[model samples]
Target: MPAFPNSCFQISVLLLGLAAGPGLLGCARVVSATTSAAAADCLVYVGTNVASEQENTIYLYRLQAATGTLTRLDAQPGGAAPTYLTMDAARRHLYAVSETQTFRGAASGGVSAFAVDKKTGHLTLLNQQPSGGGAPCYISLDRSEKNVLVANYVGGNVSLLPVQADGRLAPAASVHQHEGRGPHPNQTSPHAHCILPDPSNQFAFAVDLGTDNVYGYRLNAKEHQLAPAAAPAFTAAPGAGPRHLTFHPDGRYAYLINELNSTITALQYQDRQYEKGPAAFTELQTVSMLPAGFTGPNSCADVHVSPDGRFVYGSNRGHNSLAVFAINPGDGRLTLVQHVSTQGQTPRNFALDPSGQLLLVANQNSNNIFTYRVDQGTGKLTPTGHSVEVPSPMFLQVVSDFTR
Candidate 1:
């Protein structure tokens, strides 16, 4: 392995209907990470919508890791427009962003905590809190599983909340409102699209789509808090609209995918800062999502670094394609490898299985989930020739061995 961030499960029979809204409830505790469950024996958890409407429910599915087969477990109704999702380290809880205009008695979007049943794939609502702003499109939990961080896109804010002992959630412990504008009229506003922590969990990075900036934060895991880093935010080109970012497993370099421009940036990491070394980078070699001369409009959504540290994948909306790239391990650079058809419309998000042998692409516009077989040795994706039809598939994540 060269260098990248070191980072660190599903179920579903019970459909816990929230009286007021969804609440988290508990089931199993992960007693051991050494369960001897093969990558092909893992469980998959997915977050989608209700009939492609505004948002009303999240469905749980069982994925046959070896075959890439999916079976719906049960559906739970809560929060509005759950555009994104993240799982706790222990696979005992789940977090989702409620991308609505209002939430938790506040005029902003919010987040929800749910208990996980590794065996049944069902989730019980634990708690809900305002994410400190509107349209909470993205959320994540620290590796310690002690804090939940949320990013409000339209509201232009980021907030942190405490996770309870039982996998429930507390109110906002800290909230930061971002300021500034980008170049384009549509992209020149503050829109915090994602909140993610580096693989080491030493720092956090938040990507803003509207302002063309990637904000970095210093984390206090023991204290359960977060603050802006000394070098606060990194600026991208005007109107780039950065959406999602990822780091190589070795932690030597990082990558960011710009939503507006449909470009990929390779960055070298040295001393916790992007340095001017062989790995140091500031601009993209090229944008890889579109077909030649077939542009209507383009927006990139998600970015992921392959487990083996040899490839990266990003999603394009209007272009409706998955851009693939090969990484030069010697110098943290990217070369456009291939562009694959998502076989559906508006692929809002995708996730790789823990074993890194499978990929799931959520097509939000066409209401379906597409699966692909991943070739670890060569960093390539081949269609599995199968799909699961669902309503407004927005976000996808894996819950390994949800059954303890």
Candidate 2:
């Protein structure tokens, strides 16, 4: 933990004053005290793609927790086209996928590891390994933090990489090639979009957009391997192109956002196993992410459940809005709440701060990040009018000091 200078403290106080009113007197006090604490160094990391004009890099920013303001800290060269990033549970290591078709002369993507400097929030490259597939787009850590799982979009496969004690990635332990296609043109071949471990840590779900199915894999922590689950896969609509999946905090329900159709499906999740069969998930309902009669072209990119599990949100690319939904506590169903504009175009990725009080959206086409304040009670979002310009910002992640 470090102390801020007098000038930094004054600036923080002034910004907090402008963001909150007298009605938030009690909250303001807590925020001020927390921001002043030596351990209040929150960090934000943004991953950008390498285009003709853009460099493959990961930019670091220091977050003013009290005001949702981000101050540039540093930038490091991420390997070729870093599309997605993930941090280890200890917050000491960062992992990113270099979405390339060739790695070390092989037809595969690459994953790089970086060591996080807690004091300055700087990242230092550690090592790199083959992603076991081509065009790896997503990476995530297992609940045990013993392995890193990656999804390859172009190769349509999922791979697991063992994590070493020093935070470097070992060669992939296993790679599972996906099979099948969907009705959409983009589904000519398999396209694994996201890999997320279940809350129970017993299973991992890989969403394959091209297959129109979510494949489940049983995690073997001891062996550091992944095997097809007893209940292998859950099928979506013909051309749904399910891209992302999220689970309720209670672990009783899950939601999937379909990119091709711009719809979300709710499912009842049960972890119980019977002598006759394995655990299963039952589809509960499906709802459109767009407004009625607004039949323009749109695609969904992200989905997340609120910290409280009382609400869920889906990001629409063409609509340039966030679709909010209220969660039914009784049956895990969802009801449309509101659609709030993101104030930018092509919001490729967004993240909620550690406190769940603020949301930041990275608009790729607009090249700006928009901030929004969350209404905890009603599950609505209001723009905070706090935005920062960046280049080709595709992924945003928040790492809290406390977690570190």
lDDT of each: 0.71, 0.78
Would you estimate the TM-scores of all the predictions? Answer: 0.85, 0.88
Global lDDT of model 2: 0.78
What's the CA RMSD of model 1 in angstroms? 7.9
| lDDT score at residue 120, model 2, on the 0-100 scale | 67
lDDT of 1 by residue, 266-333 (tens): 87655333321122234434455565676688788888876667888888888788888888888887
| Alpha-carbon RMSD to native, per candidate | 7.9, 9.9
* Model 2 misplacement above 4 A: 1-41, 53-55, 273-279, 402-404
User: Per-residue error at 245 for model 1, in Å?
Assistant: 1.0
lDDT of 1 at 344: 92
Could you tell me which residue pairs clash in candidate 2? none
Prediction-by-prediction clash tally: 24, 0
